[model samples]
Target: MKKTLLFNILFYFVIISFLYSAGETSFNFLKISQGARQSGLGEAFTGVADDVNAIYWNPAGLAQLTRQQVCLLHSVWLVDVNYEYLAYAIPVIGVGTFGIYGTFLAGHITITDENPVTGQYIITDDIARASDINITLAYAKKLSEIVGDNSVFSDMYAGLNINITMENIYEDTGNGFGTNLGILYYPRYQNYSFGLMILNAGIASERPTLPFAIKLGFGYRFSFENILSPFTDEGYYKFSENDSALAIDLIYYPIEQTTKANFGAEKYWNLNKFHSVAVRLGYKFGSDLGLLAGLTVGAGYRLTLNENFQFDFDYAFVPYGDLGESHRISITGKMFGPAETNYFENKEEAVKYYKEGYELLYNKKYAEAILKFSESLKRYKNYAQAYMGMGACFLRLGKKETAKKVYELALQNDPNNQKLKEFIESTKWDIK
Candidate 1:
């Protein structure tokens, strides 16, 4: 069934869009970062573009999602202005992923007139109301799936976003359309990501300006407890999402001939399987805003509601020096269930210990790793990999005889595993 959809008409449609014209964009509101997390990172999310917010920073990140997600954000922007943002993402098992997000901002404009005699500006009775709305639809998929050749491009993802925008200033109202192209690459190295995006390249009959720009970004994760390990769970859930990461983005605006950079760091701590907390800090240099104004900080907490649902709350603060201060709040919801139900809950629990053991092994804590592997095996007698891992740990500890015995036991349970046979044959161990 999945293969049949691969050849569907939807797979053949390719949208490649880029615009490099030089001009001022009218819907400047579109340039504001959408989510609190992203904003706290100085909008450097082009690389670390995970979660539903990916729909705005780098749509290609949608390919990395394993389930359905939704997000809502509200920002008290500079100069007494405010905006609301909403985003949703859906991952289709066979057809790729789809996303939608919208940003809305409204404010009243104060009108003033200069008195000729006094040469002083006076507030007038007339005030103008202004508002802006931006909505985007996005799609993303692994390049291998789209091309039907996974051998080479398996780790490459591509995405596109269609932009719909409207701006109202006093009596002049305008509507515009645009496109964004993005790619996210996961190389052979783990926990490293590279991304690029070109966005908002279209024309408006009345506005005539688009915030056409490009972003090149990189992200790296630092992990110690298998947290945010970039590893998936049960082929359905996430197991290693507790970790810290650094992100950088080089942004270029063609119209303004300006280039800026964003640097950010974030850390996540998983209290258990059901709860997590995170903190973030960021700086944007070369922004017209002063150093103090370009600094941002944020924090978040996530609670797993159940097997299939999750919720997160986030807040961010930014000071714009004398201009004003900004405060933002965001809420995110996600739906993803483990592949196994109560019937295999034990097996799922076993995997947790197994991963902990593997990380211990990687960190050269052979004794600790053996204990964890033993705990995993206790949950499921037939888990061949746990037995194998235990054997490896014993070998690292120079207990060759015990290692051999464990390997033999694993082969007994998984008789057809050729890798185990080869592993045993290749090891040089003696049982005197």
Candidate 2:
């Protein structure tokens, strides 16, 4: 049987009208991250967010960013499927913050053959495409002053994201409208924070179904200043020189009848004024025990700065099995407004160091290339080439296990890499 998009619409209406006609049907694809870099981190941004991608992770995080930012992500799912996402966060003058997010998923096929009544067999095209998309507008505002300027919780904030979602399969269609409501509590600048959000709560197109969910997360920063203050400026405080941060996140999806929770912590040390390092680990639990384990390791550094610009690099590793490892890098640029001063005036030097890393990888010095790639990534984490280089190096070192793992990791950041695909297959890895 051949099914058309129109048939999909009708079929969906019938299902919504007759079966489970009360709440929203579960739309799981909404949970995917279309970006290459963010996915590499195990989609753990419920807390550690520095970019506009936070719109998807937690709209409340937008209040922490300075620039009006835009991000686009493409993901190739298992099989020959694909997906795309675009997000933008703009700082509104007096209103506080605004964000927009759009997502799309599609691409798959099922082949068939034609059997003639009284003739030879013939081939027929029975390809199918299914897709889902959601567009949302988000707004957040500082409520401290409004609640009470004299109150200790004055800097607290709240936000909401409104979404319009539509889905289409070979013979099914469904539409719904939902909203994500969140509250952010920041007790101090980079010191302590908390958040709560209710996601995908709304009415479906063909029925009164709702995909209700709730997520709550909290974070706190333990800094060097806090640790050293007792030793230097205030010996009266009486303390040791150590600091760490912790976060906990819990989410419940009524539609899917699933609950998830995560606890994450990181210890960071400043090597110098311009250099810093951190070790991150997290444990997640919910529907399955086998799916639970220690998350990964992430390291970040702030490289250089100038009057108008600043650069940052971030690296993370994801270990899949005893023999598999994945690496991730992200480079971020911050441009200070015209009224600010430049901190670093040497762009050529930055580029030179980056190119040198590429050279090391090209020379087939797998081990050295790995280190250089790490350095380059720490300087510029968003560079797709850096991730590719690291994957290639891991592959060349006879680390087919690590190579396959890294290649798959690279796919999270840049899913369109045919080279990574070839590498996985060449190494006898099962991508599917």
Best by TM-score: 1
Write one digit per residue (lDDT tens) for candidate 1, span 1-432. 111111111111110011112335567667778889888887888987878899999999888887789999999865456689999999888899999999988766456666766767666666766678899999999787766644677677899999999877666789999999999986532468899999886777687677888999998875646543233221111123327888999999878788889898888888898898999999988745467877999999989878788888999997766656789999998887432111122687689999999999999998788778866765666788888888888888787877888898789889999989998999889778
RMSD of each: 13.2, 20.8
lDDT of 2 by residue, 174-271 (tens): 88888777777765313556787777777777534545778887766555456554344122112233356677777776766767776666666667
TM-score, every prediction: 0.71, 0.58
lDDT top scorer:
1
Clashing pairs in 1: 227-242, 228-240, 228-241, 228-242, 229-240
List residue ranges in candidate 2 displaced over 4 A.
1-24, 33-50, 113-123, 206-210, 224-245, 265-280, 287-289, 292-333, 337-432
lDDT of 1 at 348: 75
Candidate 1: list runs displaced more than 4 Å.
1-23, 110-125, 187-189, 224-242, 336-432
* lDDT score at residue 149, model 1, on the 0-100 scale: 43
